[model samples]
Target: MTVVISAIPWLVVSLVGGAAACVPLYGGNVRRFLRSSLFVKVVMWVPLFVAFVVAVSGGLLTGLVSGVLLASIGAIEWLRRDTAGRTRWYLALFVASCAVWPISTAQLAPPLWMTYCLSSVFSDVTAFFFGRYLGRHRLPDWINRDKSWEGVLGQLLGGVLGVLVLGMIFGTAPTLLAGLVIGAASAIGDLVNSVAKRIVGIEDWGSTIPGHGGVIDRFCSLNIALAAAVLLPR
Candidate 1:
């Protein structure tokens, strides 16, 4: 109840801000905007958010179990599909590091856990839009062709804003710092995941969700963000 109540204002800000930004991006074509991939992604977030709320509400053990299950699925899939032995080893290490954060963060307060998860969500959302609309300098074609510096700037902005909005729940100063750390870590996590896919010669980790490819695809940045949030001084 408390979690839902606190998230209402933040949710409204994110949705309204996202919709407003799309207006110019689509040249006022509401129909086209509604049909866009961004719109689909936004719509898909509903179920994911529900699941998140339930998982945290279930207490630490449940969150830990859920994290372990997800990590195992992602790790097995990624490792089994990749043919490159050396890179597969690196992927294993990466997956293990990613797994630790969420499992550990399960012990934290629900609001803090939610903040960690949502920071990455905000970063991902804003980066996609800003990258599409204002991106000029492209990232290396091999790692991730679509990413750009402009998108990164947008991610930083989103991360900061997300934490600020939830400032009443967590202390403002610490969360602001955590936001920056989480934002940067989120970007790195995303890039690493993209690179892993490129190496494996696959478009997505799996096809479990519509609009969002797989659990791994959707939550790639989350564990890293959780790590950042957890590491912050209480």
Candidate 2:
């Protein structure tokens, strides 16, 4: 109805941009970041997601904000002395992917939002542990020294678990499939953003997001995962 109609454009844009990012990923770097900061960041975001569900019921376009919330990461490109086509591509795809989930909420109901966002969070949470505790094999140093097969496995496990739980809580049966898609997509999106960070010669996207770095640093993978959910039916 009204919601679905309004959401189509963002969905189309998200799928297109996310597809563009699906390349033979080289890998991701073992990034340096503050552990305490990460903890604070998660603590803050969890409530926001919960509030988002409540807000959706009361009619707020928080989804639109979700879609573009991380687009500001593009600003760093201006700081680069050697900007290239990569900058433009990353900026476009990043913003488009970020925009998708908001549009998706417009079409779907509150439960879908819960299922999608939680899947992304779980994927990241799992990946971090897997990468830190068990990662040994370094990808091509040029690609990223920090990523490993274990991290990938963790992402899948986490995404699936999150999606399944939310699906059950929300009473959405078919959302189980989201585990496979969102887990993988979110990881790929993270790797893509890692590449962008390397090119710009920086770390943590920015330090403005209160222990999370910047809006982009925190939500890069989430946006990509949300884009995947948008393409998925039910």
> So what's the TM-score on candidate 1?
0.84
Q: List, residue by residue over 48-109, the lDDT tens digit for candidate 2.
A: 55445544553237666544444655456333422554566666676667667557677667
Backbone clash pairs for candidate 2 read: 28-144, 63-102, 67-98, 67-99
* TM-score (all chains, Cα) for each model: 0.84, 0.73
Q: Which regions of candidate 1 fall more than 4 Å away from where they truly are?
A: 76-87, 90-98, 169-173
> Once model 2 is optimally superposed onto the true structure by TM-score, how far is the C-alpha of residue 159 displaced, in angstroms?
1.4
lDDT scores of the candidates, listed in order: 0.72, 0.63
Candidate 2: worst-modelled 10 consecutive residues by lDDT: 23-32
Candidate 2 Cα outliers beyond 4 Å, as residue runs: 1-35, 54-60, 72-86
lDDT agreement of model 2 with the native: 0.63
For model 2 the TM-score comes to 0.73
State residue 109's C-alpha deviation in candidate 1, in Å. 0.8
For model 1, what is the error of residue 39's alpha carbon versus the real structure, in angstroms, after optimal superposition?
Answer: 2.3
